[model samples]
Target: MSKRRFIAALIGVLVAPLLTVVMPAGTASAHGWITSPASRQEQCRAGTVSCGEIKYEPQSVEGPKGLRNCHGNVGRFAELNNDGKGWRVQNVSRTTTFRWNLTARHRTSTWEYYIGGARVASFNDGGAIPGSTVTHNVNLGRTGRQKLLAIWNIADTANAFYVCVDLNIS
Candidate 1:
């Protein structure tokens, strides 16, 4: 066979095997699922209040038996100011931001905080939960810690929510 023809045939043969390999649609190759909340009840639980601040950790359900990192739930983690101010605390008139450490299973899961039962802010932790113990920063007004909860909204599996933290404003 001519050199060009031989090269073309070789290419075709290699490409055919790859194209024929059945790739399950929607199959996640990444290990781990989002371990967030499943319902509003779990997300609405009070937060952990102490030292003029409220801290929380979302609930993570045991994922499907597989790679430790392969498959988890979706949830939210948050911290609120519980200084008896409500939504506004120190700083008078200012908007502050914090770099919070998070522990997530999915590579695209996110964490958000709510004020007065409204979605206020969110952060993506590069798909890694801050493990069992990680504190992420959040913006809060000069108000004592109020009713706030972190959430984890998983897409698949039994929708689950956990009030991993609660707080009482001082």
Candidate 2:
């Protein structure tokens, strides 16, 4: 056999096995949530707050992009929108470093933080795949028991992950 034909056959032999392997369809592989300073979902997952379905899947609070609410406007995780849930406030300096623990990595567009309908900080990723963990030093302008909304905008999709972190800044 010719060298070209032999290489073609070898490639087919190696690739056929991989193609035969089955994978579940419609599986979501990219999800993330804030852990440090404990977003509401993290607080729920850690038993620091009494929450609903979000406790089991803290990284799944995904919804349409450009939304300002927590829980991503999802009905099941809607508990994140409640202010009376006795959420714990983390004390941090004016410039706080928010840490994200990503369950799966994806191309990121931007990370935005909002408080009382005002945007405080935004980090643009230029549509690059993020690492399993991501952190940003955000200057939260206001102080004294503020609920900050953090949004991770996906690069290709119209979806974004949302988390709310309550903070008491000094």
Candidate 3:
């Protein structure tokens, strides 16, 4: 083989693997979802709630923050926002712990929980990288059936993951 061709081939072999390793590390793969109290996506993942694409990727219901949709207004995950979709409400107390399972940790701005259009609780992460698991104790304050929308806002991105948890408060 020609010396130039051999040199080019050697360069390609060396650069390709390095690119693969560097690319994946730099690519943003932030993922997280509410697990305890069983968010809509969690229920779908657990086979307790029948859903669409979100059933396979509970940690991926991401969109811009300030939107109150469970599927983050994404068409593929719209099933999560369906109020009549027969999602099972877990029995909860006035105060319950909401747990987040982070598959790919990201720097977080804040974690917010809402019920009936009012934010009930929030935790500020202050742009710090979060742990594999995060928890927030929320006080629902209201009795009877309710739906809670939890949002995880990413510090570096203009996006947030949304999880809707149905609760039957005692």
- Candidate lDDT scores, in order, read 0.35, 0.91, 0.89
In model 2, the runs with Cα more than 4 Å from the true position are 1-30
lDDT of 2 by residue, 81-141 (tens): 9999899999999999999999988789999999999999999999999889999999898
On lDDT, the candidate that comes out on top is: 2
**Candidate 1 minimal-lDDT segment of 10 residues:** 32-41
Ranking by lDDT: 2, 3, 1
TM-scores, one per candidate: 0.32, 0.83, 0.84
* Candidate 3 lDDT by residue in tens digits, 54-133: 77789888999899878888788888988999998899999999999998998999999889999888899999998899
21-88: candidate 1 lDDT, tens digit per residue? 87554532222212221112222223212311112222333233221110133322222222232332
lDDT value for candidate 1? 0.35
Q: Candidate 2: minimum summed lDDT over ten consecutive residues — where?
A: 21-30
RMSD of model 1 against the true structure: 14.7
Most accurate candidate by TM-score: 3
